[model samples]
Target: MATCQPAPTCAPVATCQPAPTSQAVCPQPCPIPAQFGCGPLPKITNLVCATDFDKAYIPAMYQHNMDIIAVASVGAEMAPSDDITDLAIKIRNERIQQNQKLALFARQAGYGALPVDYNEVAMYRNQLMGVAGMDFSARWATLMVGLLQQSQQSAQLAATRATLPQLRDQGNINARACANEIDALQRWLARNGLPVSATAVPGVCPPGAIAAPYGTGPSAPICQPTCQPTCQPAAQPTCPPGSQPAYPPAPVY
Candidate 1:
């Protein structure tokens, strides 16, 4: 058999390709005015006045006027705790004295001097119990005002409860935005022949892909090496002093 001619040596093929340029993709900007929808408008307070006028006009007017006065007085009485406590104490004492005076007046008028029978005594006792309960309520109302003034805990409690839903919504929105960006980056890295694993983690760039160096450091140098015409030996990843290598060498084909 004839000896085989020596195979001709060919130039080594270039394995390193230039990293693909990343397309400048930006997220669609959020809309202004937020496209927020409002719920139905409330019926105006004047509507109540109009309806009241259509009914027995004089009585309706009187009732509405009294309602306004009562609301105004209650609002004034329930002003900040510092101002309300003294007023509440004075009101409670006056109310108790007035009830006692009314009871005495009724006894003198022969309206409450009934005989001491089980039914009569029971009725009187119930009336006295009701008056006592009202007095206790007034005293408790004053005590509550004092308690509110002594601590700002209630205000803090209300603020904490109000912010909870807003905080939860913000967290959810951030997480979703992060996931979308990461997915896009993974696809980009894979298309450019860079090793990357898909992940759900937000804001994290794909691992193992080379990024342009930010400064003159070795890890991110000012000038990058260009691919040679022929495939050269793969460079070993440089490790910092006292640092371990992150991965094993890629297998040579």
Candidate 2:
């Protein structure tokens, strides 16, 4: 009692934190997509250990998505030429099917892919369009032809330049798909009275040819109701040039 002053009339209010105001939080998008949209670095190293194959393959995958996304986006803009609606849809559908097949090669190799980023797609769309005032059909066809040519070129390079047998097979499949899609795009352009390049791959049907009854939607050949053989064989492994026989013999007892 000697040192203690009179008890404070009231204990000071205990300092207390109001329960943190629970603010609503928005979820964030996943920072990484599908493991960098391919595989982690070490896995890619294991799969494509050879030199420069990755260079060919990575660009091929990029262009694959570019063709799918940009071309599909352009389809919606074809309202100025409504007559080609079914054909446009058909082309989009075909590319999607082909892309699924193309993508499997990577997935089976333990790499996978993500869809092309929307930002890249928007850039592609701008690249497809030119000066604002130009007439729609002709200008659009010219730009589209340019794009398809670039797509096919990249695919063909991957086909020829990839050293690994698996990559070579994938390149062939990818190039074939690009060829089909370009042919489809050309036909779509031609049927709508736009000029297709004389040197472009010829369409299955000449310009202005009418699509068959089932061209669009599930009935289309590419999207047949029955499951088709979308998966192709991977390349078989081989022995090194100077290593043991290409095929190993049965072990002797």
Q: Return the top candidate by lDDT.
A: 2
- Candidate 1 lDDT by residue in tens digits, 1-253: 8997766654343343334444444433222111111101011111122233212122212222222223223423444343333443443343333334434444554445322224322321232233333343333332222222111221222223323343233224323433443344344445546443421111111122222333211111111122223344555554455544344444443
State how far residue 202 of model 2 sits from its true place (Å). 26
lDDT tens per residue, model 2, 77-190: 653665334545654675565567556655665556744555545654664465332255455555455444444544555666665566666667766765776676578667
Residue 58 CA displacement from its true place in model 2, Å: 4.1
Error of 2 at 115 (Å): 6.6
The regions of model 1 sitting more than 4 angstroms off are: 1-80, 113-253
Pairs clashing within candidate 1: none
C-alpha lDDT of all candidate models, in order: 0.29, 0.46
lDDT of 2: 0.46
TM, every model: 0.16, 0.43
